[model samples]
Target: MRGTLVATGVVVVIALGYVLSCIIRPFRDCWVCDGKAHHRSKRNPKLSRPCRWCRSTGKRLRIGRRAWNRVRRVQRDA
Candidate 1:
């Protein structure tokens, strides 16, 4: 039973790792500022700017299912 529990935990960890690896963007906009670091100027203290890269969505890019499958196919063929 202990071994089974360990195996389940390992599987869960692996799945979580895979999911995390799929995240291309770990933040929104510049990722360095959380969309606010760049505007930290004394001249402009009220800049509510959004990140151009993530469009203010604090999520990473995810591989589309079809594109992932296509890459997998190429790798398998190789």
Candidate 2:
């Protein structure tokens, strides 16, 4: 009985991960700035500022997916 529950839990986790992987795009526009060059500040110090990660371009890439794509491209080229 305990073993069955463990197995079921594992399956459910795998299924959820699969669904998330499919739903979340590998690369997408930055949600925080909405593709804008700057992001609004949430604190009292400043009202807004340029994004550091996207360099204000508002484009963001998933690290894992980007690496996966590079690997596949290299393999295909080879």
Candidate 3:
């Protein structure tokens, strides 16, 4: 019982931290461009193209923030 409690507490803390992070910093670097907003061509290093995933913004909304926004939208519509 004691071990289970400790494990649950750890999980809760981690979850809270992630929630807070999502609130404070809702956007993270794009995985494809790594915040550079563009990617170099494989054939020619000099040529580059804007990142499609982030729409050349160099950032993407966090999954947690996206979920929160979805929930809010549903609640508002309901």
Worst ten in a row by lDDT for model 1: 24-33
Pairs with backbone N, CA or C atoms under 3 Å apart (clashes), candidate 2:
none
Write one digit per residue (lDDT tens) for candidate 2, span 1-78. 999999999999987775566458666677667788697866754688898778898977665667767888999999
- Candidate 1, residue 46: the lDDT equals 70
What C-alpha lDDT, on a 0 to 100 scale, does residue 36 get in candidate 2? 82
Could you give candidate 1's per-residue lDDT for residues 1-78 as a string of tens digits? Answer: 999999999999987876665564333334545544343445777755554555555443344433576798999999
Of the candidates shown, which would achieve the greatest TM-score relative to the real structure?
3
Q: How displaced is residue 25 in candidate 3, in Å? A: 0.9
Q: How accurate is candidate 3 locally (lDDT)?
A: 0.96
Off by over 4 Å in 2: 1-8, 11-24, 28-49
True-structure lDDT of candidate 2: 0.76
Across residues 1-78, which tens digit of lDDT does each residue of candidate 3 receive? 999999999999999999999999999999989999999899999999999999999999999999999999999999
Instruction: Indicate the residue-level lDDT of 59 in model 1.
Output: 42
In angstroms, what RMSD does candidate 3 have relative to the true structure? 1.3
TM-score of 2: 0.42
Clashing pairs in 1: 29-51
- Please tell me which model should have the higher TM-score, number 2 or number 3: 3
Candidate 2 weakest ten by summed lDDT: 18-27
